[model samples]
Target: MGRALAGAVVAAAVAVATLTGCSLRIEEASCGGGEYPVLAVNSGGGDCVPDGEEPAQGWARYPEGKVPEKVGDEWDIYWSTHTLDENGEIIELPEGG
Candidate 1:
């Protein structure tokens, strides 16, 4: 009886861990109003760099909220920005082209 109870407890623990253990990985985290869980800042809304006509050329923060220039080799950022602007235009950077 004790063995059966122990097995059941272990099974329950494993199930809980599987359901809540950082499984939902973000692909592109952006800073927007409609975004659900943005892990980084949105670089398109603010003032872009000089001589930059496109937002894609601007620098965006990583998923961990670190600037692209500040992040190190060990840092890995994942995010997916699918939202659009007021004109209903999907703003995508030039990279990944």
Candidate 2:
């Protein structure tokens, strides 16, 4: 019974971690013309920033459509609305911000 309880606790911890694992850290960003305008940023343990300024860092690239949008002038990334800032660093919003 003790072993089973421990296992359940561990499983719960894993589940919680997985639920909050996805995180987006926008270091630099910009939007413009093109079929798939790129938003330079470091996301999901990868660097998607444009320019060869820092190749040593692994940046991931995402289409403009996939990028999140900001809520008004605030730095909140509204994933639900599918809107995000086109330039500058990204800011994280609270649970309901």
For all predicted structures, in order, the TM-scores are: 0.23, 0.23
Off by over 4 Å in 1: 22-97
Cα deviation of 17, candidate 2, in Å: 0.2
Candidate 2 ranges beyond 4 A from true positions: 22-97
Candidate 1 residue lDDT tens string, 60-96: 3233433232122222222233223344344553355
lDDT, candidate 1, equals 0.37
What's the C-alpha lDDT at position 12 in model 1?
83
RMSD vs true structure, all candidates: 12.9, 13.7
